[model samples]
Target: MRDTNFLIENNAKAIWHPMAHPADMRARPPKVMMRGSGVHVSDIEGRTLLDAVAGLWNVNLGYSCDPIKRAISEQMDALPYYSGFRGTSTGPSIQLAYELAEWFEPEGMVRSFFTSGGSDSVETALRLARQYWKIKGQSDRTKFLALKRGYHGTHFGAASVNGNANFRRNYEPLLPGVFHIPAPWTYRNPFNETDPAKLAELCAAALADEIEFQGGDTIAAFIMEPVLGAGGVIVPHESFMKLVREICDKHGILMISDEVVTGFGRTGAWSGARLWGVKPDMMTIAKAITSGYFPLGATLIGEKMAEVFEADKSGLASIGHGYTYSGHPVGCAAGIAALAETRRLRLNENAAARGSELRQALLALQSRHPIVGDVRGQGLMAALELVEDQTTKKPLDKAKMADVAAATYEADVMIRVSGNNIILSPPLIVSAADVEKIAVALDVGLLSAV
Candidate 1:
């Protein structure tokens, strides 16, 4: 066995974790995950915990996925790496692209552009949106509109279009020409609208107003998440996406769905766009693409967009953007295996059933715990927003939320605490018993906070 103390000390000394302060790691120390199986993970200290966050909202199939592991091993041994750039590509990459095209055909996606991860996928979509407009002889259309509190990823282009200030404040002077409208979050909004349907209409009107104000001809695309993920699992009204789609179509603006978190059956559907019966011009996907076994993402192009690019006679459609590992053979192999298993197990159906049960349990928790102000999510992706006062809806302080997270960890449930929200996105394969355990552990943590 590895020396836990030595490993922790070395990690604190040498590593700077993402979304965390370096100094804080030395003081509090980070959990060193040693192994994982099913939906549970073992730390270096030999403690096992339910991974409710599913390794940062990925890992839909959970750990010990034999098919994915075997695919990766076989691919690495046969042909580990190959450049998909230019005219050169590998067999696995080509196969995966064909499979994805077929899989996303129901959502009107006919072409797939591979990437390294979610951020890359978002960046590619943003660039492609602008390029698509330029190719259509509307070069002035460069602005992007997105819903407030939506996350697109950390890349410069994606960060510019991100709706959350927390992700944007530090990185100022982001790409220019990006605007945001209020999200269709009924729990909190500028309209003071309690009714979800009304709020969605108001939000859609606001989007239309923004497009008109910016001049529809000047806007290239409007990007958003079907269900906002990193910004606290904010599930909008059922009609929200459809309305946005209509508005975008009317204005000739491309609609880009940032499905990084909602793709691959996380939202009880093959894709979030499919969940709402809305087709986007472009869709960014990652995380669950390879079941977190290998880093792989793709920006899917809609049939219309693909046709435009295909019909372009100019050399502009030749494309100048691509990554070295855009379609790593090993990653594609893993993705192929993961997709097959996802279909065989029918994980989307399981996610829908488990998600309903989980959401109901979370609502029950809100009724019992004064700290839980709101419970919101779709499918397995969910969040519990804590508040100091139920009447006024005052959010819980960061320190208190940290305490709650610590308590949850001690209770053997690994959840993610972002601000006052405790996010839970267990693997899609999570059983009903697993959901119960998560709820029980969260109850212990909430009670401790009280």
Candidate 2:
């Protein structure tokens, strides 16, 4: 094995990180994680830190999930590689599809179109949505509507619907006819509305207005995260998603719940749609499907979508898009094991209890620290928005966030610092003690930033 110093030296030099500047890497070298156990990871320097980001919001079962590892190894030995593109199929993939159908049955998702990861799942969902409209002979229904702070994925199709400018600006000339509506974020919204129910109604009215302006027949789908993830863990009002569903139904537009981050129990329910008591037309899911043991995702279809795709004799109904690894047997095998463990352990229940505790702790931290301007979350996914002034709600600069993040690491907990928000999504397997540790670490970090 190479020495720690050697690996650390080549970390930033060897690879270009997806969402980071090349120059910034030189200013602050990245940490090289050598190992993970339970909820803690060890850096190359042998410093073990509690992981609150859950390996980019995957790793639901934690690092030492023996069942998933065993499942992957067992499947690899049986069938190392096979394609699920049309004529070919794998056993694990078939079983997984059936399992997913059962798992998301409550959400009305009856079918699963597998993908390689979250981005692929999102891309697949968008394409399927447009295709759904085409099959219905409403070819003009090609536009998409999304929330302003939503993060769909990186593909041109996905990026087109993504509301965040940071994800869209550099990749201009993206798919046209995609529009955005204001997110029902009480902390910061154009309406300045603080009440959740009223905010939800206003956001829903905005969606209806956009559909009216664009002509409802011209809009294919309204895509949104049940709980906005990458843009910051902004948990919408309980009524927001339900209201969106009602509007989409009235407009005859499909609802695509981008559950890439909120899927598989991160949001205290089996899925975020269930959390809000809404059943979407399609759901783009990944992340916890295989619990980070493998790269796997799927665009889950509702019964209505199934009927359209199945009943169609038209060539337009044929799915032209598919990844080479649409349903890799090993990935599906890991998913089966992960899902089983997820259910057996009832991670959703744990997430609910832990999430409530964590949120209260964050509220306490907010009371003590003036820097914490806003605290938002649902279930295990949470974020603290740092600000220069609580009254003005002026966001704290990146330098200060970085300092706080560094301090959190010094306190032996790793957190994700995005823009001015400090995001925390610890593994679902975390216990009460673990939650306390995370809260204490954040308290220390907040102190440094203050």
Q: Write one digit per residue (lDDT tens) for candidate 1, span 63-164.
A: 989999999999999999988665798989889999998999888888899999999999999899989988899999999999889999899999998999
RMSD (Cα, Å) for all candidates, in order, is 1.0, 0.9
Query: Which pairs of residues clash in candidate 2, taking residues 3 or more apart in a chain or in different chains?
Result: none
184: Cα error in model 2, Å: 0.5
**Which segments of model 1 are wrong by more than 4 Å?**
1-3
Residue-level lDDT for 193 in candidate 1 = 96
Instruction: Please give the lDDT score at residue 240 for candidate 1.
Output: 93
Q: Write the per-residue lDDT of candidate 2 for residues 1-450, one digit (tens) a residue.
A: 888668877879878888999889877888889999999999988899999999999989999999999999999899988987759989999999999999999999999999999999989998998899899998998898999989998999988888899999998999999999999999998999999889999999999998899999999999999999888888889999999999999888999999999998999999999999999999999999999999999999999999989999878898899998999999999999999999999999999999999999999999999999999989999999999999998999888888898999999999999889999999999999998999999999988876
Per-candidate TM-scores read 0.98, 0.99
